[model samples]
Target: KTAVRVSCGEEHTAVLTKGGAVFTFGSGRYGQLGHNSSQDELRPRLVAELWGAKVTEIACGRFHTLVRTDSMKVYSFGRNDQQQLGRGEDSPPSVPLPVPLQQLCATSGLVIENIFAGGDSSFATCVHKKDLCRRLKNDETPPSVENMVDTWISGCDSKLLKKIKKEIHETFSSASCMNRSFLSQSKDKHFQTSPDYPGLDFSLAQSVFKKLLKKEVLSTEVQAAVVQLLPALDGNPVGVEGLRVFLVLNELLHVIQKLKKQPNTRLAEEVAAAVQKLSPENLQIIDSKVTDVYKRDFFHHLFLRIVSDKPEMFMFNDSETLVWFSSEASEENVVNFYLFGVLCGLALYNNSIVHMSFPLVLFKKLLDVEPTLEDMIEFSEAVGGSLKYILDYEDDDLEDQDFTFKIHWDGMDVDLDPQDPQKAVTSQNKKQFIDAYVNYAFNTSVEKVFQEFQRGFFQVCDQRLLKLFHPHELQGMLVGEAVYDWEVLRQ
Candidate 1:
């Protein structure tokens, strides 16, 4: 005998003999026994109707029953509440009936893959012969098949049809009649209702359904409601909360796009103001702790826009923010990054006068150490090398200017009368200062200091920018050349 244990909230066991006989034991609250009446049979009871047909599988819902025949037909009984029995009603069946599921099966000539019965619902998967063949051809596990003959038989019964339809309407209408106050009052009620069975909160589900129905009943009215709610979406924590930030960002982008086309002056002004109020710096600080991809995308777009429009804001900030932005700016976040980059480029160019002191200070700090000199030289060389490629390109403006020159350094800390500051400070001068400073303090060769500079520049500058520096100039300084090669230097 092949025995199967079943669980319908609690445990029960059923056994099937090789000769096709079936027996069951356990909880029987409804007529789930397939033998009539609500009886809790503790011992295995032979199911008489299933005597001739070979029982292949048995499934138990909270208060319903399902049995599969060897020929792939299925039989069901007990509770039909929620149309879970696939028989279309909320009443319990007194006897086991064959279910009519032939239409579902005839659509694809497939057998049943499996059957799953939840507390108030049942689902089945059918595996078509062609699909199975394809799986087998690909060395995949082909789904075992069973025909849903039971569903078709049960559905064909006139009495069952009326019961199913009436039950559905009653369950829906009764749920609709119960308002929030009524539900709250019935919260402690012990009797199991069809819609609220298993004690799940159906308030949200009911609301969603009513909203859907309302939308169908009055399309124009619902559209006006949507328009009214559109402005409030930003404030709707329940509506927008727990949603991916990416979705919000996408919606924001769509709004921006639409504004570009239609030009909603008031909405545009409001959105722009809202964006400005929501500072990117604050958003970045908040985004760092978040691991959600959608939220990250949202914050990423916001951060990019802020930085691009106000590059000066990020110029003096820590590199962590830049790294974070770079990491999150994928194809999904590209629009944000592209807009941001454009903004940053424009900001950098437009605000040159105001930012002159800052970049100069950054450059000075970088050259202050012996290692910084090597890094700067390497960076400059990379920049020069990339310029070489551009200079070689056809129809380019760069070819009109002198492309090569040598940079010389007389000494460090030249006493300029502040009014007579030199045109520019060279890498050699910076290196000399770093060597002298380190030697006087730590007694180490400037080479070690130069190495540190290389690491620092790579850390600070974007990889694309670093690749633009000339390498020959860097190599000349490293080899102790008094005058570094500037053949490729821009005049």
Candidate 2:
């Protein structure tokens, strides 16, 4: 909020704040504001495009701007008709882009100490590193495990160790900092982060974590820093670049396991809690665009009515609190089942919510894990209770239970054996009868709709990351564990 310096163009203004944040206001006709737009700003607005840099100085031309960062890199934007930006004519016209100086620095071994821009001229003064209070930062790659370990072991009492520790805290506690880290900087490929290629170096994260674990001090610091990262995480991070942190965390968990350390189930569960709180509340709300409001309201309205709207597709317990696919499904509305799966997918990918928690059997089915009679017990107490009761009965008492291959479910009768509809259930065949019943409930009766639902659910987060979780873990991540102690829940 405190301005360190201010520069004025013909009609624009640039303010350099104390913490090295830049803000702009007034005319943006030629992008002199450097806020990535030509729209005029009535109030000073922060230029968020430059996230990681420590901007030391700012200058404004008649219709352009330039900034120098501690990283010894100069970025320029706005009118470049005279090539004043130190970039080619094809460079971006409005957005602040780095002025290509890597070759100049590499060959001349020069450190850019200062930068200035006005009219059609700009300058970068080269100087010795001794002239500055500290060594000038170069294009900062993230801390390598090898370097961090060496520093931790060798610089225990030195200022360099202090600097590394500061960097560690900043990188772990800030989402943007973590997102911009672990890049594959070759050919500047780090700038190209998309769904197909997230541009994260997972191998780098693994190597760093592995090395850090070797030193007790460094290992403790790494765990502390990562734990510090949780409170700052905003679920459904913005852009593919933001997703890199999550991938890095995933890799970190794997490395911890390979090191034979206990996987942090509590950490994972805490993260899952944060994940479930992902809300569309942060999205821009435009009145004219129905979709802008659809995602927010959809969870509030649609999910509130899902069970009531399609009672035939799902069977519920006596209280209607528990739900699963009906054995007697309606073929006419099979597509609705798929759409329901899509809603579940949206919950995973888009921060939508379902009103009720599904049984663990649902997650098992989604992960292609086989369901058993015990799982059925959680799904349907009456059916599962009866099957277990029959199985527990003595050979003489089994006949008194009227055991048969035929049973009634969801208002429809289903035969365990299609070949023998009236087959008897005896002690010799009790296991066979229970297995058939479990198969019919989880597989035979609902396979088609479940497949479609799975397709729809995976459509959003349908990536392979689903395999990292066990069925119970996936259930926790999706539905979350119920809180019995409300007063003890973390805020």
Candidate 3:
């Protein structure tokens, strides 16, 4: 909650958190506080009206306040007698409201780039989307993945395909070329690249690979460049932005395995080996589980609530203690989990552990080792204990216990035996129940988000070294030492 930006009016003050939340205080006589009141506030109070909007910039006029969201929409509050709010409303004189952008403005492709407030007026700068896109396109060197994909889809004659193949070699074969590729240019986020945030557009990377796969020639050339160049990437990259090459490459592997019905095993192996050789100088790691099990408690407390507290985006275990991403997490929220994974990768690459409260099964999954019943026990004591009891039961008639394939978890009734919804759990198939539950807990239920988290994680880490670690050891390495007992050493 530490303030990152602050702005002061004549009497009122505005504070912005690192998470982009805003707080206001000092005075509220003109509703500058955005609390729908004109009462003065002695202490800084959260601006509830702007909650979840993620304000990136704030400006204060003599009697008004303006904020620009990450989405670039502007919000204003306080005195608007001079029409400084730009709300175009005739409602109450003092109100917290978004600037009313006309429908034509959107259709005209006007993009808001900056905001300012001073004296008794508010102002915002706009750029034509077409011109902006043209400038960005011109800035791209070595031809972006989007440009390459678009050109291939436009039509692939022999001459163009040959040119494309050569371009692929020139682009991917050079570490500098690949390093400069796939950066997310929105809001200049790429300039802020860190291990915790690779600033690469993973969706763009994966999609580009998908398109490349369609044209056998382009995909093959890409495979060759990856096999040759990625393994030779600079371990100590020039800047954090250079780290994006690993992410873009890892995403290529993900697309090959997940999307290809007939994947090339040799290509997959070569690409995987290249990614596995990645040992970056800095490190990190998960969802709520990923954030929760940080090696250090400080990071755990600091980051856990950022994602875990968003109940609408994540579902908790029955105990409401552990976090599993909600299947219904909004598409935007799901992408956040991916970035969360990148940060986790940052922690891992730097040889630092974070507060990732995930069960041991997560580490097992990272190593590509399947989760087992014991992993289930470690994840959920009650469920795993009962499953163990059922396995140990001498009674031949487990049917007498009246267990069914239908089980509830994270507020959903999942059918383990979808083929036969009436399938009963008997002694003969009790193991299947355990397997299904474990899979549902660690895999099926949260597949999309976890996959994104995994992709984000491997963006910086090589799984070969991770695979060498046992689940328990990996867990300890990520979340710090769990066994605090010193008596063994004393003995």
Candidate 4:
């Protein structure tokens, strides 16, 4: 594979091939290309200076380039802007100069493996094989590359990371509030909240909510409560009932927001229980307003017990959930139902011991009837909101690995003959289907849907379903696209 690095100078880029060859392009004003040339190179040009040692990695900063060799040595050239080259603040080097990263590695007894350069900063990795060996020997615990990196970068202190995260949340929350107030005065009703809000309407909100709920960052009970509260909000005016509904919804929203800021299962369960108590009739009314098939399906499934005395089973014995996405059901209802399936899958995945028995059942119900790619995409987007919820509790060791979600398309041809030698293929197909469903359910984008659910819940309950409970302070938590985050982790 070829590794590429771009210089902060914005005029230069570097590429290193698996064959240990180095190439550079863009401005060579500072000889950052290490080719002893002052002229700018428009296209990739070979750097003969790095011909000896096999260069494993390359990094560049403004007017500077850094190279790491297979021997664990480091080489630097060009301007030392902010001393990013790890060289002392002196005159710029005219030619490629070797730097001693070995001292830094030796001090920590780590082997330098990688290097990265930013505009005014530089980062490097030192593999602590001995330390990992020692840890493995002392305890049965396995060593992870991520853990090693974390240790090298931040001493691997979970507590310190938590503190940093809290600081970030406070900063973001303050910024969001300021932005919300400013936008509220705008003529556009949608922009009344933050312009950057992910879920612009009820359909969007429901989609995000299911994703978060699935990750177990938000709970089913909270979902049930939101469903219960919708009808009450539909009829009530801005009176005592309205105020109570608002408060309760706001409180729930705040809890969700906080959980999104930092995921906690306990908080999710509390929210879930509150939602469970909400009236199903109210949710149906809200679903009607949204005019989406997904939302309606969600409401129907969630409140099946209250709607009809008998439980309306959606899943079959084969572990498929059949959903008919048609013009008969509004887009909103369809999207909502899709999100609900994702949520159920996420919830079960989080607490496997408790949910293992039901995943197949849930999957069977959702997949029994073939849903289109459009439906799957919408569902995937909804689940994307809750990615943080799933990632928050993931094992650090697995953080750098790719997560695969196997989706089975009904249209895709597969040989299913009983006498075929590839009987295992059928089993694989089943596994992939289950995995895709679960992955989408636990995705981060679901958090955005959860936020929308909070808004709709309060609005519907206060306006229509007020008699069941009084409104109290409510909070809305919104999480944005998190699939990107997952991809980054894999990289």
lDDT per prediction? 0.41, 0.70, 0.72, 0.44
Question: Which parts of model 2 are misplaced by more than 4 Å?
Answer: 1-145, 154-168, 274-378, 383-491
- As a TM-score, model 1 comes out at 0.26
Compose the digit string of candidate 4's lDDT tens values, residues 68-171.
88888888877765676677556456456667678877887788757877776678877796865676588865333223323323522445654534432332
Best by TM-score: 2
For model 3, the superposed segments whose C-alpha errors exceed 4 Å read 1-302, 312-322, 488-491
lDDT of 2 by residue, 318-433 (tens): 56667778766677657767666756766555454466667888988888889899887887788899889877877665655678899776677998898999888888889899
Residue 331 CA displacement from its true place in model 3, Å: 2.1
Estimated TM-score for each candidate: 0.26, 0.41, 0.40, 0.27
Ranking by lDDT: 3, 2, 4, 1
Two-way lDDT contest, 1 vs 3, winner: 3
Q: For residues 3-48, what per-residue lDDT tens digits would candidate 3 score against the true structure?
A: 6789999999999887899889988888888888998999999888
Candidate 2 accuracy as TM-score: 0.41
Give a tens-digit lDDT track for model 1, residues 1-491: 43433435244445655456667667666566666666778887888877789877777777777777877777777667566678745444746777777567977698775676778667777888688668668995422111111222345345565454443233222312212212322434312322212222334333333332332222222223333333433322222121222122233334333323442333323333234342233222223323243232333344444555544322221322111122112343343433333323322222211111122212323334223333322333443344344434454444244332222221223322244343222332433433433232222312233234334334333546524434433222222233445875654
**Candidate 2 residue-wise lDDT at 472:** 83
Q: For candidate 1, give the lDDT of residue 127.
A: 88
